[model samples]
Target: MNKTRILDVKYALTQILYFASFSALMGYASVYLLGQGVSNSLIGTTLALVSIIAVFTQPMAASAVDKKVIKLQSLVNIILIGTVILSLCLYFFELPTMMLLCVFVGIVTFMMTVQPLFNSMAFLFEKYGIQINYGLARGLGSAAYALASAVLGYLVEDFGTGVIPLFYIIGNILLIIVVYTYVVPKNQQHLVQHEQQNKEETEQKQLSFFQFCALYKKFMIFVVGVVLVFFTHTIINNFFIQVITPIGGTESQMGIAVFIAAIVELPAMAMFNIMRKKINCARLLKLSVVMFALKHLLTFLATNIFMIYVAQVLQIGAYAIFIPASVYYVNEVISKQDLVKGQSMVTVGITASGIIANFAGGILLDAVGVYHLLMIGVVVSVVGGLIVFGSIEKKKANVME
Candidate 1:
């Protein structure tokens, strides 16, 4: 293989290793907490707190790259090692105290923001004639999630949820080694140039908040639509395990369910890459919006566990396409200097959506039940989809003008 291809492979492997364990932990950890006798409110609150902090931290993390505030690899190493230590420590703690332990772990892991950082790295690599394919690298993460999730499912079912802490310990250790040793090298050029450019831009442009809003108004509308879509989906994701457990699905089944969804993302994301060249992203996004709305609509009609399992195929269109497309599309409009802030805007939207989804989903589950909540998701998604559809047309009109 050529040099670029080789680097791409290495990059993909490192991300796969990094995200696989993390996704597994994310998909199953709440269940683990529940198994430990924690209440739903506590779990939701803990996750919300982490995401709220993460919303603030993402921009800071991206700023680290933009401003040369910290060594990128150093931050990853610290967070990874810190997560492992916290996991090991949690094993020694008792009931109510473990909730606090999860909270601490969430804070550290939440701040371990790398997606935008990696995007910047990829952009830098393009300048070096070593272009890293983001989608392919990201697909490896999906594959890792599939494998790790399968293992976690069986482990959770056979051993108990207590094994989760051990899994976290092992996973983060592997992540630390892969990232510190392989993905990031001690190269100063990307960081130095990025810092200098950001410094120049800061000196040149100091727009007021209102001015900044006006500057990104088009992208902002897109973000708002995407956020609402995310809000509806989080209703499903945040409570999926809780919804399935009572249905007699084993931890392995839960694993398989998430595995199925994550694996489906590979082909779905590939489709987006092909379609991006042929069709407009806004149009593609509308298709995803429709798909998700249909998905929840169908879910409201599902009766058996198998029906719910099958309905998740809709996730391919819902998350995989919508997310990457939104990111790539927004990049088209924003200045290079504002890339991190733009990406952070996307993250902030997601964080805001997640908070509302979790709190609202919890209440809906308490009031009407999971299936009924699917009906609510259906309505919310339709509204979000319509907003995107209108925005797409308005953008097209602006271009013509």
Candidate 2:
């Protein structure tokens, strides 16, 4: 194969492994915690702690990459090594509550940072003239997530929740191999050249963090809208097992629900490039926000497990489009020098949403029940969608004026 084809294949394979590893670590975290005798409130607290760590660490990770304090490959290596070590530790050794909490925090910190860092690398590669079929690769990643969730569901059923750490170790090990063996050599030259170019461009005065925030006020608004939407999204995601259990769904069925949610994204993500040619990213994002509200409404109204399955189908309009669209929107709106920071800002929004969701979803699920919690999601999603719509409209009006 030619170099481009080879690079494309490697990138795609890397995405599959990357997201599969993520799925293995995070997809069933709540269920595994519950199985370990942790209460729902404690599980939520754990997740909130993870999010708090992410809030601080994600920006540091992005800044490190942006400033060349660590190369992308080096960062990936560090994360993979940490993940493997932690997974092995968790699997082979039983620890106290504090120790387990520390391990969980470490694992989440690495996983949360990986997505944005890898995404920034993809953007850098594209800027360097590498033809990455990002949508197709991302779709494959979603498929891998679905497959992993299904397999993990079965494994959890048969072997117990202890299987979680085993899968984490295996997935990260494979990811390490893929990075060292396949991805590194293919893209090293481009990355080096891109770094050199960035160095040359860095002679200009860099904006202070406060100044940067001031300058991107509009973009910040968009980020706030994203925060609101994901607030609801995270609640649904974290509490989904609870939602279906009342309707007689087992672990396997929960896996199927996750699979359904993930698989439906494939077509939408695969077609993202084609769709972007027709609809602009801003409008696409607005539409996604609307769909997100609809999805929450449907989920809130779901009476049985099948209804929840049907609701998962709406993942196409919600996350499938949102992912690619967010990437494009940020790339187009943010300058090259601030690209990593910009992506990190988006990650911050997501993590913040997750923090709120975990804390609130956990408490509410315990206090009022799943239906009431879902109704809260419905209300929040609608408000979020309207906020995005208004923001987009105002931006357009300002441009016209």
Give residue 229's error in model 1 in angstroms.
1.6
Q: Per-residue lDDT of 135-245 in model 2, one digit per residue for the tens?
A: 778878989999988888888899988888898788788878776754444446456646755764673356666777897887887778888889889987776678778
Candidate 2 positional error at 284, Å: 3.1
In candidate 1, list every pair of residues with a backbone clash.
none
Q: How good is model 1 by TM-score?
A: 0.84
* Candidate 2 wrong stretches, greater than 4 Å: 1-7, 59-71, 120-132, 183-222, 276-282, 327-346, 394-401
Against the true structure, candidate 2 reaches a TM-score of: 0.84
Prediction RMSDs, each to the true structure: 3.6, 3.9
Residue 110's C-alpha lDDT in candidate 2?
87
In model 1, the runs with Cα more than 4 Å from the true position are 1-10, 64-69, 98-111, 114-133, 183-187, 190-209, 212-221, 331-344, 394-401
Stretch of 10 with least lDDT, candidate 2: 392-401
Worst 10 residues of 1 by lDDT: 392-401
